[model samples]
Target chain A: MEKIPVLKIGNLLLISIQTDIYDSQGLQLQDDIANLLQRHSFRGVILDISSLSIVDSFMGKIINNIASISLVMGAETVVSGMQPAVAITLVELGLEMPNVKTTLSLEKAIQFFNEKFNRETDQDGSSQE
Target chain B: MEVLKSKTLKISEEKDLLNIRGLIREYAGEIGLPEIYKVKLLTATSEIARNVLKYAVSGRMTIRILSDIYKGIEVICEDNGKGIADVDSAMKKGFSTSGSLGLGLPGAKSLVHVFHIDSKLSVGTRVRLIVWRK
Candidate 1:
């Protein structure tokens, strides 16, 4: 049973799925992310799925669930690095993951969270302390 | 149709889904399936293969590269468990009995160029998925 590794950087967690994970593994990942979010004060989660060759309806649902769970735990989720072919297939497959936010690459995903948190900090005006 | 290449795989567990995807990718590439169609076929294959494990508990899949007037790949998945009771309803979106999103059958059909399903209660189900190089 291989577990997908989750790395923490700053206040965000990065989960780069590098293998063609099976159904159980995807479920395991959802559970792991939930547990991590419960234990940490992370503000965002970045999921990189560039290595995944296919995103079927099952996988699509898993990803969506991850994003939803993260949101409930007070963390935003950004999925990045989807291959062009996968993009086309996903839409054609009728799995519009409206709940998940997506970015084109890791840089964009990181930048997205950076700007978002910065804006939040500025709005609250508590980071000056 | 002419059979360019063919292989058989068993779908008894979750890991077999991965193997089905891998084998489909290989044959799709070898047959020069365009990137978009290749991805479509692969995704459809995964959906159907996973269905076998989820519902049937065990099954067999056959991959074939066929050429008649055009080149294409075909996958046939057969399961021995109790077949789908109402395939028409099963093909509808958001009609899942297993608490899933219920997009497996309909979504798989939408991805490929050709899709066929045959099932009988108390017998089994056979789904045929095909994508052509165009």
Candidate 2:
């Protein structure tokens, strides 16, 4: 009933998926997030899924889709703050997250991205040397 | 002595999923799983049931209370639809032919204590998942 919230912090967009992240809702939400990523051309995205108690096939697919699309858009996606129980469930389900990054907290994720950004900038600056 | 089973259309319909969720919840309550655990079970069941309805045409799901001592629930979802050609690959996360996020089987497997799946090409698929409260 409650719509999933999407927030933008700097170049990164945070999509707070509030539901169980299973079945049709999960698919729909993934599509919405993908559209947002393509439309806005964000540099990074964090799927804050701490609210989801369980991760099902549909939800997993959405996460995978987002990660895959982010790469195409030149944006990196990170999934942060997944419940341990949910994580365990996902492993047992045999869901493999290939290119997506994962973090324990959003702050840490942002920091990780910031570091990458700085590193890339430093490399470019030194190229002239 | 609690059991529930349902026959439904292909895996895309949402109504069949709702019915399956209700049934799983009732059984979870009867088995006295903690509220948090019950919610997890409900979500897991819904995901798998939806897959059965969507991927396999005319599937049936059965949930039964295993025994009093163990306080466990076992669910079997069987469908004679197009079978999964690669069971191992299908079990992998983010591996979906349908362009979905591909978390359904993996997610359901994560929620319960024991999860097993079997599929034969053109023969359909069957999944058995078990959760214990004790």
Task: Estimate, for each residue in B1-134, the C-alpha lDDT of model 1 and write its tens digit.
Answer: 89999999999988788788888888988988998898888888888888888888999999999997889999999999899999999999999999998989999999998999999998999999989887
- The C-alpha stretches of model 2 lying farther than 4 A from their native spots are A1-3, A121-129, B1-12, B15-47, B57-64, B76-128
User: Could you give the CAPRI-style class of model 1?
Assistant: high
Q: Which candidate ranks first by lDDT, i.e. highest?
A: 1
Q: What is the per-residue lDDT of model 2 for residues A16-125, given as tens digits with 9 covering 90 to 100?
A: 76644335565566677678877887899888887776666556767888898888888999999888767766665567899889999878888889999899899999
When superposed on Cα atoms, how far off is each prediction in RMSD?
A: 1.5, 5.1
What is every candidate's C-alpha DockQ against the true complex, given to 2 decimals? 0.84, 0.26
On a 0 to 1 DockQ scale, where is model 2?
0.26
Model 2 chain A — which ten-residue stretch has the worst lDDT? A18-27
- Per-residue lDDT tens digits of candidate 1, residues A54-114? 8888889999999999899999999999999999888877888776889999999999999
